[model samples]
Target: MPLLGLVSEYLGFFALLAAIVLVWKDSPWQKGTKVAATIGAMALLGAVLPAPPEDGAATVTAEADGKAAGGGSAAGVLAPASPTAGTTPEPSPRPRPEAADYRGMTLDDARDRAEAAGFGVDEHDASDEDKSIMMRLNWTVCFQKTGWTSSGTKTIDFGAVKNGAPCPAADGGAIPWPTMPDLVWKTWKTAHQEVAALGTVPGDHIMASTAYLNDQLPDEGEYDDWRVCVTDPAEGGDVTVDLRVTLELTHPDNGCPDPDREDGDRPDLPDRDDDGDPDYRDPFPGDRNRTSAFPNGLTGGSDDSSDGNGGGGGDHWNCPRTRWC
Candidate 1:
């Protein structure tokens, strides 16, 4: 079969050469016609010839055929190729870094540490003051929460306070307690304002009641005309959210009743010095010396006098001795 194939290829080439020579020299055709004939013969010859193999093409094809034949099933069918074979693999995502503690560190230091560990930092005031950390170096971290966000980023939140301040007993426990103020003799509106000034919700913490028995009460909006007669958990008391402050009020028409005196006839007056003498009756109510000088108004001399005891003469009684007197 090899010998026959070689002989047939040689014959085809000789026949093409003979046809070209006959059209150009022996045949009586025009110049253009002869050239066309020669070209057709050359095209036909090229179509019949086998194409040359590319470098390593035959070797690859032969190896593929050999593999298919050897790996075929007993029924002589070749197996399907693997879907992922010879494909470039996809790269995997990088692992997230572990969370770290940032408590007890300076705000600046905590931020730096968190960023270095491939984490984002969120900071806020732990004292519940809503104060901004103007100077990071001057603030210290009191607490921290470290976890991963839904977007796959590791984040750490820090609560901080000014340096030298003690951290709260627990997280989110740094809110300062409000102190109760003196609200007696003040209008209901003024009393509510005072409570609100202490950083408390006045409506939730303050309650009012009529001071006099059988007195009809008005709506809360009319409380501006009412006066406070007494307060629960009186002045200088520490107020908290759970504690309610109750105020005894008196209507504008009915004056405040005296809790200390009976018969409800005694009038309530401002005693600046608390010396039993009301400011209206006391000549020197604001003078500490006059209000606290002698016990029971005895004839004790004034300290400012030359005698040092106001004992210069009779009936002096330490009265009209000082400039205030």
Candidate 2:
């Protein structure tokens, strides 16, 4: 109970005061005084600081058995502690932990992180309903409250659910938009490398969806028509990178809309759900029943995506419908 609350903070100043008086005041044992003061100062800090966090397994077990509520009726989950009679509220002086991405992690993992960051199991929210899905510690973390501003030693609380439970898609990536690179307009090839250089993974922090229009098919003259189009969460502030974004690609001649495009004219309409011919060109315009799929779109083949970086992706697909792969 001595270090459980803030009243013990004054003990530090008191120790400092006594140490200073002992070292600087008139004393026959001046040499011994300073050493003793140093040891005393260290002892005060050691005793006043909170103890290392208890093991996570123990805490979870305690909550499961209904002992962490600290009183009767077996509280459904950890209930906030009430102040003891005659005790003054304490000021927090402990350092907090740096920000972390808890998404896709397990509840037990999230709990361990919170505890290490100077938080107690009772200090944050987690209902028994949330824990009902713990199967070999596989309950997945779905939501978190902290963002880029988090720093060392600060407390961070997150929410979790069963592995298969529905978790809301992150509003954006875990990294802030300012921190993310400008990937728009860059070829699929270069974009893959950029994210990797920044320590992010494709399909994890980025995704690419490929589509080739009639003009993009082999029927047309060989040309570099496939390029990156729109991205989700558009480039902006405070945006957290969710998983990789889907980069829609089309041939330059296919006439996709582009705000950056110089001409103001809208491109011609597509086949409208019609199929392309054996030559890989749109054969049936505006006929949903006869649509065909042609060659697949390109995304810089290899294990790495992007036409520019590795420059060797030429995968094919079968399209008997409105669009090609």
Candidate 3:
């Protein structure tokens, strides 16, 4: 039995004995009366004080109560169990997919495949022109890079060019810059095709001007009938789509003009002074004082007070005196 239970049992018995002794010795009564008083006091004390708990039973009961109150063991220590002790743990998410190669495929096919594999696709021009990919079907993938972004989103990038066009030698490499081709004497249509083959849009980069005098501006619809007479950047000059390239053109029937003559000269205009400049462009066509209408203040042959046409008005034909003429 526990020490506390034994001590309590002994205390109860002692209290009963003290009550008997007081009733017997302190009362001035007959022997029978004293005996009756002592017995009555004993019976009252027994009723008030409960019997001590049995040894083994008391220990077992205490342990059982401690457990019922959430104490861990017979020692009465508190349990440190968690609130979620019996529950199953949640599972982790699946891993992300890996990147794939997309070279040598059509842009449309490559995009579809990348998307199907859970990746976003971005495209770029593989040439120095930096043109946008308009028709996916018309462009083929030259190279590709696939990987995850900082946000963990799968993505792919493709460098591509028009079908049948060659790819750059390395990934993300730009196609070599093209040198201006000698398109002189070629039909406008042929010139346009050659420029396009070099990855340049003829309408955006190539311009045409009339090579003959008194001719109307050339039209794109009749480009097949016009022939190139001169190229702006000249033959073998470095060219790109961003540069403005102009071509001097004339009709096949009219034929090209002399390459050595001044740009705006008219074959019909007379040059009495034998200067390279035509009569209309020369400020002093007869005196040979000035060869062209170029504004270089007047040279020699002072103000003769006569116009080039033998008129009286002093140089009235040199209208505005600017280079526009």
Candidate 4:
């Protein structure tokens, strides 16, 4: 995200400077003394460069142009929150019930616990070993996508990497990324509408992990300390098109909050209320905050096609509002 803003601002400055130099090529300004003076002035101005706009600001929304929503990840625009108009009392915060047990708990058991505790769970069928060990207790918050859609078997495991034997303990473990395509290439084709990654939910990582798998990351697991939001576009028989975005949060590790630590214990962070159900609220469902960031477009490939590359990734293809032509 830092690199995106920096490159955008620098490119704009370079273009303006180049245009000025080209226009003055044959004029008196091109001569030795004048050219030197102009170059010096330009360099001085460039040195005092203005700061690039912040990424997580309100104005900057994600677009599907040449890339996926949040693919190029410029950061600005925070997701919308529920409205508050009437005098209805706000829901009280609550902690989830204790996890049943961890004895021989399979991946499904872990997923159930996390979801029951208020996190979203996305499954990526990684190698047999990775899948068996890593999935046990990882869960994140999930939102539903509306309109026409189909379910499938394949999944991309962004957070878990195969490490020979079983995955390490939640507190001290590491998941490596295979040398193949990482997050970017995983969604390059259009067949898959949902984009899921492994990381913590935004703004929830108070306790840092002891064993460093990915230090650049601020949170634990894929959902506990990471944030992910994805979109699925609905096809249009008419000229107009439509799309839906789903925000997700997953908890990867099992580190409890430390009251003695600076941030204080936050037992209330996960699905505090033992509701065993997800609260369905469309935070950005049209109207007041209607300008959705994800893009919707038609896709095309050869009529006679295969499953890989040339087939446009899979059974479908959709253009992004921000990254495609």
TM-score of each: 0.30, 0.29, 0.36, 0.14
> For model 1, how does the per-residue alpha-carbon lDDT over 12-128 read when each residue is reduced to its tens digit?
777777778777788999999888888877776777667867866776566667767898434443445557878887867545456676788999999998898888889988886
Candidate 4: segments with Cα more than 4 A from true spot: 1-19, 22-24, 29-31, 44-50, 55-325
Lowest-sum lDDT 10-residue window in model 1: 295-304
Q: Tens-digit lDDT track for model 4 on 1-325?
A: 2232245656646665665666577555546776676666566555555655567542333232323343664445345675688869876643333333322334455456546644444544333333434433442211111121124222211223222223324412332321211122121222122221222112221222221111123233332333221112112111111112222222233232342457532233322222221112212222221122222324444344556655554434433332343
Each model's lDDT: 0.70, 0.50, 0.69, 0.34
Q: Which 10-residue span in candidate 3 carries the lowest summed lDDT?
A: 1-10
lDDT string, candidate 3, 1-325, tens digits: 1232245756656766776677678877889998887777666555655566898678777777868688555564444555686788785653555667777889999999999988888999877668878989988898877666768787788899877566777855666557778888998878867776766444667777777554444446866768888787788876654567777777676667787887557343356776655454466666555555444544433355765565634454454434434
Order of candidate numbers by lDDT, starting with the best: 1, 3, 2, 4
Model 4 TM-score on a 0 to 1 scale: 0.14
- Comparing candidate 1 with candidate 4, which one achieves the higher TM-score? 1
Q: How many clashing pairs per prediction, in order?
A: 2, 32, 0, 39
